[model samples]
Target chain A: MGQDGSVPAYENASKESPQPRPRLRRSVEDGWIAGVCAGLAHHLGFDVRVVRATFVLGTILLNGLGLLAYLVIWALTPQALDGEHADAPRPAPTSLPRLDRAIRALRTSGRDEAFGNVLGGLALVVLGAALLLERHGVNLRLGLVLPLGVIVVGAVIGWSQLDRAERSSWLNESSFSGRRGVLRVGVGLVLTIIGVLLLATQERGWAGMGDAALSALAVLTGAVVILTPWGLRLWEKVKREQAQAIRATERADIAAHLHDSVLQTLALIQRKADDPAQVQRLARAQERELRAWLYGGGQSAETTLAAAAKAAADDLEDRYGVPVEVVVTGDHPLDPDTQALVRALTEAMSNAVRHARPPVSAYVECGASGIEAFVRDHGDGFDLDAVPADRLGVRGSIVERIERHGGTARIRRLSDGTEVALTLPVHRPVNQSLNQPVNQQTLPLKEAHDA
Target chain B: MPEPRATTHGPIRLVLVDDHRMFRAGVRTELDDSLPVVGEAGDVDTAVEVIRRERPDVVLLDVHLPGGNGRGGTDVILGCAGTTTESGAPVRFLALSVSDAAEDVISVIRAGARGYVTKTIVGEDLVTAIHRVADGDAVFSPRLAGFVLDAFGAAAGEIAEVDSELDRLSAREREVMRLIARGYQYKEVAKELFISVKTVETHVSSVLRKLQLSSRHELTAWAMNRHLL
Candidate 1:
């Protein structure tokens, strides 16, 4: 520990100290214990083997001072960033083939698997060293080794629980910080149990009945603390994969729709590009179909006021080769009353497009009060009363069509344009308990008018 | 109705802002020669720079653009908030879009645009709206009028606070908007409601001011849901 503290000051005064020096950090990837030896060897510009040999000899001859100093260095120095020594090679294979294979297995396994393998290998190394020293007539004390082993294993169990949440696969990015709290508490509880059991069994002989019971309890607690989170994480991963599969299915549905209608329309449009009328017709038809699919949802049979009016205007445009400007605001389902209103609007609009000048405007609005529409045209103003009975465009089609539905329609000629206004009240369910009168339904007239 | 209000100093200049090159060309060709194209821009940053430099009388701004931190046309209006023409008069903005979404309409209106029109409008009507905007009058298309009615009119069943008179449209204003939503021009609306065209303009302008200045969250949320429709 004293050497670890003095090394940085010595480096600061060396000949290469012209510039600011880098901070000392442990080489975790390269060192076997904690990278303290490798870090010291790099800083001192000495061979790592020489530094490691010095520490081992000092531990044997200097009353285990080297072991205490190594631990102190491990506590004081920070580990290097993850990839700092990624190019460093693994430990050379020992003459013992099985031990080498076990160390190699620890190198390539998952985090939890590597964790167990490292602990097992460390125990094996410690027991073999003790046997070797005993054969050399240097009796190692069982008292120090047994308690330290228990404490190190307990610390490893607690530390492994710290970062299981960081093992990112496709499970979840959110809820990880929240999951860490419960897992950390479980780890702390298991570590405390192991510590208390070790203290209580210290009076009994090591490897005796008390020790056996202590080990059994510690293993059971560790397994429970570890496997609960593992199972939960696996379940979460499965659920996320299922959600992804559902989304892929939806995408396939949309793709099928695009191929069936849109691609066919595009091909037809290309074949008739020389004829402007044919191309325009194809494009408009395709647009209506696509809009219905996109916004109409699943209810193709149900038509709203806006949809009905637009379809009527589009039909007129296609038949006459004339463009009609239709503007709609607010929309309601096309009930019987509003359907009558839409029919009246169609007659009024067709009159403006056929008998009047181009660029006529149609506007419709659906509101809480009722549905109101206007079809205006810039044409020669004519009086409603002066029109002959034979020409029933205004009287029979516009006015009477709406009056039959219990609504009203009016036509007025202004200085610059003629305006037709139609209004239909919305139908709301009557409450019988409130004694409200049910709305009277008007019978349909047999004569239909076409402008 | 041809050049009804004559400009003594020639036609009002225009700056077109839209992201699509084809749409800009189409609008340029469709516009009458009376409305001169002074400049054009494709994004919010270029729009602000061109408007500030050319000082056009009216700007036909597309409500959705590609720049300005994704706030799009609203950011252009704010970026040029205090800009004035060479004569020291404030420049006018007329927003245009292909869709009549209430949220986009309300946001652009609140950002101080004078009017909103759909891209499917007739060329003559677009010319008339541009002239109206340049003359410092608000132009409300049928859909926008209906949106205003839904937001501020009492027909929406919205609760009106005692102190929020400015947030509510009066009865006459509602009538005028309803007529406008029925595709009536201001002149025609004046004749139908037995009022002068100047009074009709006043009602529409007042409604436009309320739409821009009022911060009623309930009105905004109602417009978002399009419950009136």
Candidate 2:
């Protein structure tokens, strides 16, 4: 403890040195006891055995002053937490170093049993010294004193070496939670009863009973003092975990917002920069879309078939260079039917633009029982039978797509062009809901539309 | 109706039609002083009225507009066809559209447009096209000519009779002719037929003579008119 005050002076000397300083920390990897010789050898750039031999020689020549100095250094130096020792210079092999190596081998042989062996060795040494003193007519009793000193030294080493969390858990394995608290109280009460009964049975009177009671009260108070701080610390840890979870959610929201708004707008600007008119149009459209998304304007309940058809036409014109003219007459259809019809119409219109000459026209009308649409093109038409099997534009996209929606597609060739007329039933079947399976129906006129 | 005399040295009378005002102004500024802008209109109704009132020699028309069922250029062309010069010469229309789509090209050409050029065409080329259309010669952007040929060729399939001239070519010459008609360059035709460029040239000359055609463009037009492309 007296040598502990000199540690900061050595740390300061190492910091002030311009040359690379070998850190003067205790070498737990290659050390006897507190590794004072190993630490000095590492700092002074000498072999550890050379430092140990110098210490042994100096202690013999200086009449035991070297041994006291060694103990002081051992108490002062800190263990090198990072176990590395290669920085120091090596020395020539000598007999003394060889003897030190043999000693290290013996010390490490039963390393796992080292703690109990060391304690037992100290007890034997003290007992032998006491017996020798008694034989020389000096009375000494070491039974309780030696054991208590050993315990005190062990506690001091443990308290200095263990980190904070490990020390806390070692102090209270059963934290002051409900079940453990009840168990601890039961054990304490049983011990107190046993202590009081022992005192009464031993013919120790009221004074012994009072002493036992006071000691019990002191133990309970000590437990309360220790457990209250631990409970507060555990609560703080839980709160910190909750805060981290909330921060993660907030970061996710910010990422989503950047992806939707800033990144999408930048991509649009890059794609449409070649044409100024197109760039302007895209900017205006995105502004409206963003504002609608931000201000909660997209929640309107009414989505008409006509408006949807117009949007699909515009999208087609934007994607493919073909233009379409759509004319919608009468009221909007039911929402589910409207969606189905819009999809079917988009497919038919896509077919017309791809296969036929365009300037295509779409006419939509809603009647009492059903809705109808006609997509017409004035291109050079083909024979219905002549359409190859691989051509899905007419057969699959137009006919099958409409039929899947409980609708019918009729293709007829006029003298100048071809027209596809689609009719969708407004009401579903009696037993079917909006989300029911598709109804597959066959048309009678398979050989139609020779355009 | 009197025939408008072809004046060689004078500027062609032109009416510019477009929905975008800035685009119209840009075109007006880009055109040389030789081709004067006679009038401008944004929609189909106004365009037709302006064309009839002005009776310009060439009408530069945009294919899409707000009025007249959204087929603005075709509508203007069809409307002008009814009111011609005293000599029965129709007002020539040159479609100037941003869209180079096959459908737009074919539809306007079918509606009596004498020429079609996309908006990407530079000022000099557009001026040349206007002059050619005003002179009663068909003018088209190179790719747009293909669309025109396809549309009119398929329409005339029933009326056209088989020509013995195509049969006169040898098989190798015929292959060269088909490739040349489809707009392959001479070197491309040579590589495709696994023949030398000189051999391809020889075949082309022979095919041209047999068909009584003058150039590659004429051969393409003749083949398309016969629905052979």
Q: For model 2, how does the per-residue alpha-carbon lDDT over B1-229 read when each residue is reduced to its tens digit?
A: 0124355657777788999998899899888887889899999999989989887778889998778877778887877777653335567888887553445655576677766666756676677677766766555343442332232222122112333234344556545543433333456557768898657655543432333232324334443332210
Worst 10 residues of 2 chain B by lDDT: B151-160
Candidate 2 clashing pairs, residues 3+ apart or interchain: B1-B85, B1-B86, B1-B87, B2-B86, B2-B87
lDDT of 1 at A366: 69
Each model's total of backbone clashes: 0, 5
Instruction: List DockQ, one per candidate, in order.
Output: 0.39, 0.01
Best candidate, DockQ: 1
**What's model 2's lDDT at A135?**
27
Candidate 1 lDDT by residue in tens digits, A1-451: 1122223333343333342322344675667666767766654556778989988986887666567556534433445567754544444422354542454455444233323333433443344334323422433454344334434433443343334232222123334643654555467466545644554444444445555455445644553454343344445445555766988999999999989889998998899889888887777667666766765455544388877887788778767655566767667887666766777898888888777776577878666777778888878856654555444644465566677576777777767767787887777543334222222233222232222
In model 1, state the lDDT of residue B94. 97
Where is model 2 chain A poorest over a 10-residue stretch in terms of lDDT? A1-10
> What is each model's TM-score for chain A?
0.48, 0.32
Best by TM-score: 1
True contacts kept of each: 0.36, 0.00
The CAPRI classification for model 1 reads as acceptable
Error of 2 at B220 (Å): 53
